[model samples]
Target chain A: MKSFLSLLIAFVAINTELFAAEAGMPQLDPTYWASQAFWLILVFTILYISISKFYLPKIKDNLDNRENKIKEDLENANKFKEESEAKLKEYDLILENAKKEVLKIHFESKSTLDKDIQSKKESMEKEIEKEILKAQKEISELKKNSISSIQIISGSIVSNIIENISGDKLNESSIKATVEDVSKKNMNKFL
Target chain B: MQQFTVQRIGPEINIVGVDLSFTNASLFMVISAAVIMLFLFLGSKEKKVIPNKLQLIAEMSYTFVAKMISDTAGSKARPYFPFIFSLFMFVLFCNMVGMLPYSFTVTSHIIVTLIMALFIFIAVTIIGFIKHGFKYLSIFVPSGVPAVLLPLITIIEIISYLSRPVSLSVRLFANMMAGHTMLKVFGGFVVSLGILGGWLPLSFSVALTGLEILVAFLQAYVFAILTCIYLNDALNLHH
Candidate 1:
């Protein structure tokens, strides 16, 4: 209140000084001051009322709405980006799992195939050994049969030559015994 | 001088002892207010997310004043934004309308500017008192002053404080009045000097008109910013 009163006093003092100095100036005219003041106050009041009541709120709302929309749009964009990133991570995980699956299958099949091959090879080797032993026994029997035939043929020939040369069918048993003894002594050479 | 005269218009009207007669000043004031209202009305009527030129101007003016207040007075001055915005638009439109040929400049009058300044002065003083109580008086006393010089500093501070309204009102009035007067004086020179010699003064008048328009906007800006500064002092009470 003191400040307001002092303000009024100061205003009067300043107005008086200004008015006294510029008495001829039209702005200093006291008669028009009242009307000017009245109209100024009236017009300014209407302006203030209309602005505060009507226009400012409208502008504020528009700005606020636009700001909210922009914020919403930005948030949506961020959400979409994050979603895509998550999808990408999921895709990568699936690809890794598939790769692991393929490796597992490959190892499983490889081990099964290796076991089958090992058994087949073992059976094949057993069959081959059995065939080799049978062939060896057959070859020894053929050799033994050929050697006895040769010995028999040689003894007949020798006996026939001696009968023709000596012109005597001398004692068959003694001849046969001599032939057997000689054959036994010279068997290695004849064969 | 003739331009500044508040000629009576229509019938004489008086209320109490005051001359409530509608004058040219009143008419222009009404015109300025109407122009502002119309501008705001048309600007906000659509309220599109994408604003047209008129709406753009309206929004710009709002934000302009909004930023000005926030910049100078901080958020504490938000409640008074409308008053300050209206004041700026009124003064700006008045000055702009006055720039028209044969138009009377409302701010050229001392009484008009003084009224506004005194009102702001009182309002800000009241706000200061309300906000700080007796501590508001400490505004007149400077800190860090030697005790011996404190009295002189306090007296100076009070005088300066009281002179706020006077200076605020006078600064605007003098600038508008002087700028308009110079333009009129130059215009007279252009007419008095015949065509051949008239070119110089005519050119000078052109330059002065441009300068006056700039001053018109500048004075309104200065007026509003000063009001914000005063509002800041009242609200914050910083030395």
Candidate 2:
């Protein structure tokens, strides 16, 4: 506090002295040079110290802070970018593996289905072939039965006509023999 | 003419036959220094990432001086950046303040510029001697000179080497004083002449004022750049 007052007093005194100095051409006047030099040295020294001490450091700090922040931000961005790229690669890898799995499943299912269809077709064909053979055998049997019955009926009719015309019954054995002979002779033509 | 005067503002003190009265020149020098201090201090107080107007100006000035030092004196002269920056700002402020009507032009005086130049000259010479020792004398002896003409070249080199401070100070002081005086003379003519006749001198004064402002900035730049060059010569001893 005491120093402050003294400084104030000194400031006023210096200013008063400056106001009292004679006005003239500064080049011709050598008297004021000393005062000017003294004040300049004092003021300049203070200014230089203040600037170096108080001012430049702040500016340097600001600049350094800005540069450091930018660098840190860039580093962070790069780190995140790398992380995201790695994640994307992992995602792509997983998708590729899933697609391969799906393809394998599809092919496995398709082959299984093709095998089932082939086995079913072979079984159905076998059943149809058996039914066709049975039907053919039955038709041949029916034809044979019908033909034998017709032969029997024709023999009976002939025997009855012979009895009516002669008024005497012919012997069964002879008739039978006659019938067989006749049938034998005309077999090729009739059949 | 009135702007060049240095009036004493307080009681005169005579110490060992030297007049040490605080004068208007002293006051303005202090003002210039104070203004610089305030500007820098206020500008850098916040230090925002996206700088405000004041901060931008502070940053620009900082980079500007740093660039100037590096350009003129190379990276080795980085240590003297504060001194060179201070000199530039001080001179610039003084010249600009002088451009204000009725304000004193500190740079217009030979004494102030001379003192600054002499300091630079002495500092550079001392640095040269300290760094290179007696080998520093080799600067005066040019390379590839014929044996017969060596002495003559050395003498001329010495004279030119000694004149650095004089030329440096005079260049600034003369430019500021002459430019201000011309502006004042033209302004006087404008006032003395009637309205119809005054337009010519007034227009010239306006143009001269604009030119003087440019010169003020240029002189400050010249002063700082020359100091850097001298510092470069001292540190590097470039022949």
Model 2 earns a TM-score of: 0.74
Best by lDDT: 1
Pairing residues by index, what is the TM-score of model 1?
0.74
Summarize candidate 1's per-residue lDDT along B1-239 as a digit string, tens digits: 66787889999888887788999999999999999999999999996888899999999999999999999999999999999999999999999999999999999999999999999999999999999999999999988999999999999999999999999999999999999877876676555555755677688889998898899999999999999999999999877
> How do all models score by TM-score?
0.74, 0.74
> Which regions in candidate 1 have their CA more than 4 angstroms from the true location?
A1-23, A95-191
- Lowest-scoring 10 consecutive residues by lDDT in candidate 2 chain B? B188-197
Tens-place lDDT per residue, model 1, A1-191, is: 58655654554466456445644678877888899999999999999999999999999998888789889999999999999999999999999999999999999999999999999999999999999999988887976786666556766676778889987766656656676687678766844
DockQ (model 1, Cα): 0.29
lDDT of each: 0.89, 0.85
Give the clashing pairs for model 1: none
Candidate 1: C-alpha RMSD after superposition: 11.1
Error of 2 at A65 (Å): 2.7
